[model samples]
Target: MRIKTTRQQHILRIKTTLRWLLYYLLIFLSFIIMTSGTLYKPILLVPLAIAISINNNIYGSAVTGAFCGFLIDICCGKLFGYNAVILAFFCILTNLVFELYLKNRFINYLMITAVVSYIQCWLDYKFYYQIWDYENVGRIFVRVSLRVWAYTVISAFFMYLLVKLVNKLLMPKEHLTIEEAINTNIQNENKR
Candidate 1:
């Protein structure tokens, strides 16, 4: 009886995990589709962050971060991993500070997008396009950096709206907050 019960619990857990994963994958797909078109000029990063942050997976955030980063690099036709590295780091940091009153407000995320956009744009300008030219470095920095930053911030708002909408279509089950889950386990063990 004990062994059967344990096996059943394991199966149930696996099913729950798989279901959660499938939902996130669909949300990620929809996000890509919405951003790919002419409606938005590649402000996908901010929206990606908003989307990832809504879910319960810490690992998912990083995975989606790299995915979106790679997507941006590919769509914009730039060297690979330029946005991936930065985005992965941002997601990791966001995961770490989830408990620290970090509001999910748009402007807060927009600031993050703007800052990362600045760094990404600068790196692309300095390293990829103007590495040897050296003459137009100043102009490139001013124009490209500002353009990307503005675009990213603007895009962040749209992404927030989309995330809000997507949540209704596919909300994941509440898999307890980290602290709550641990506490519940402890309580159950004490009872046992």
Candidate 2:
């Protein structure tokens, strides 16, 4: 029994590691696609991060967010760690809020994704464009930032579905049916 339990634990750990690796691969591919010379690319990572946060624990969410943000910074050619810090912070907050206060519903996820995406877009615009006093900053804000926010929010629906599917697929199938349980109990009694 002890050996069986240990084996099961080791298998569970391997499964968990594989699941996270798949998630990271998905996010990395998403970043590549999002940054592939689109005319107006959405901040795809925001909704993705938020979706991940909703599905994961606080530590998982934070790590995923930081990973996504680090990719964003690299792709955007911005200073390192800006998006990393912001995304990690928001992901942690999202996990806590959802765990405590908010129900994990589709509508709630969309609302939270919208709010967080909006804040991220606004911060990006304010720091990169507005503060720099670039010419036609208002035009850029309207044309770029607002559009990014809208697209990010719209993409949240898909991201939420995708993450939920992944979670479902990775969930452990540990429960035994009544018949199976009874059979197992009988076998144990016979052995005793």
TM-score computed on alpha carbons, candidate 1: 0.65
Name the lDDT of candidate 1.
0.63
lDDT of 1 by residue, 1-192 (tens): 122345555665776566456546754664566456663355565455645654446787788778777776666776798777777777767655653656666566666666766676677777876878876678766666666567766766766676655554555333444566678779999999
Candidate 2 has its poorest 10 consecutive residues by lDDT at 1-10
| Colliding pairs, model 1 | none
- C-alpha lDDT score of every prediction, in listed order: 0.63, 0.84
- lDDT for each residue of candidate 2 in 1-192, tens digit (9 for 90 to 100): 122355666777787787787788779878987889775777778888988888678999999999889988988877799999999999999999999999889998888889988888889889999998988899988998899889888888888888788878774556554567778899999999
**Model 1: lDDT of residue 42:** 50
Indicate which candidate wins on lDDT: 2
Model 1 residue 60 CA deviation (Å) reads 0.5
Please identify model 2 stretches exceeding 4 Å from their true place. 1-8, 173-192
